[model samples]
Target: IKTAVEKIDIDVPNWTFVAARLFLFDLYHRVGKSTHGIKGEPYCHLKEYLKYGKEAGRLIPNLGEGYDLDDLNDYIDSDRDLLFNYLGIKTLYDRYLIKNKEGNPIELPQHMFMAIAMFLAQNEENKQQRAKEFYDVVSKFEVMLATPTLSNARTNRHQLSSCYIGSSPDNIEGIFDGYKEMALLSKYGGGIGWDWNQIRALGGMIDDHKSAAGGTVPFLKITNDIAIAVDQLGTRKVAIA
Candidate 1:
């Protein structure tokens, strides 16, 4: 990236585009390694990658079980890599691209789009055509899925959809229960918006014993900690609450 940036500064304007290509290079290497144990070489039979992922249970649990992965290679259009701008491609490579155990991206730009499309069209009667249509919609920048769909679709532990916003009434048990729920959602890379309006103000008195309640601030304090505890893919430093 440093080298890519330096090239960008030194009058190689196309280096901005080249940076995404560099990321594509990394992705191809990862696929090569995963499918054939050979870095920097593409799999001669690309479907083997999906086959291996399913066999190893590293992809969507029952990926292409009834459908066919062979159609994937036929569907993927690598020319779409040119469609991305610098920031668009950078965001994908950094935050959304699926990675292998070694932290290498296994999906190319087209492959990622197709993976998401296939996952969405798995139950369709004509899956390949439906997947292709979906891929065309997204790859052409005509429409895009939610962040979670970009991040988790076709993944082994898919938690697709962007965020969760639900709440519970305020109380000792409710506050703690909300915390537990928030923590679980955050654990799976969700941004939760919990309603805390029902809680009393600072130093508010409890109705039962007339004791001073710590109020909403005290209850919300642990939220930051819980978010930190279960970071999103270890990228987002804390949960968005």
Candidate 2:
């Protein structure tokens, strides 16, 4: 992988694909050994994979139940794996692919895409067909899902919204409540856009007393701490602005 990456330059940029393929080979070998005790074919036995994920508490309970797993498995084009560059595949492998308790990846890129499609189409009237259509666009890279949606859609957490905007009122209860809300949103991989304009500035009056307010900076510090503390289940730090 390192050698393939090093070989990538302006002249031979296709080396990125080489690196990705190498990385994918390693991923396939690892998952195959861990799950099936052999070097298994890619995109094979996806139903078993979903069952394993549910049993391991890595995926949503209704993931495979809502769809025909065999049909969905057939929709997966293992060739789509070739479409990803090294950086893209690496990012998905590191952050998005469902992993076990020991942090080994269990799902491939197509599996992740199919899972997201199945999840998003779960509420549609013709869900099975809708899921196939969703899978077509997503796996073919015709549409891109937002970061939170891509990361959280098929997982047990399932909070797919990308950003949360909230207003923080001036009072103690309101301010604390806003912090709690931020923590909860951040825990599920949502970026935060908080309106602290309502908060009092430095040296502002509190409870009709003169100059009792520590103001927005201190609260901002606490907010920063919360972002660091609840970091999207350790995938990445919460983005707060």
lDDT string, candidate 1, 46-163, tens digits = 4665666565555776665665566766766777877775667878878776666677656567767877888888889988788889989999989988776787778765777567
Per-residue lDDT tens digits for candidate 2, residues 1-241, read 9999999999999999999999999988877765663445755577878877787788888886667878877778899999999998999888888888888777888888888998899999989999999988988889989878888888878788888899898898999999899999999889989999998888989889999899899999999899889988777879999
As for candidate 2, its clashing pairs are none
Candidate 2 stretches with Cα past 4 Å from truth are: 37-40
Provide the TM-score for each candidate, comma-separated: 0.83, 0.95
Ten-residue stretch with the least lDDT total in model 2: 35-44
> What's the CA RMSD of model 2 in angstroms?
1.4
**Predicted structure 1: lDDT:** 0.71
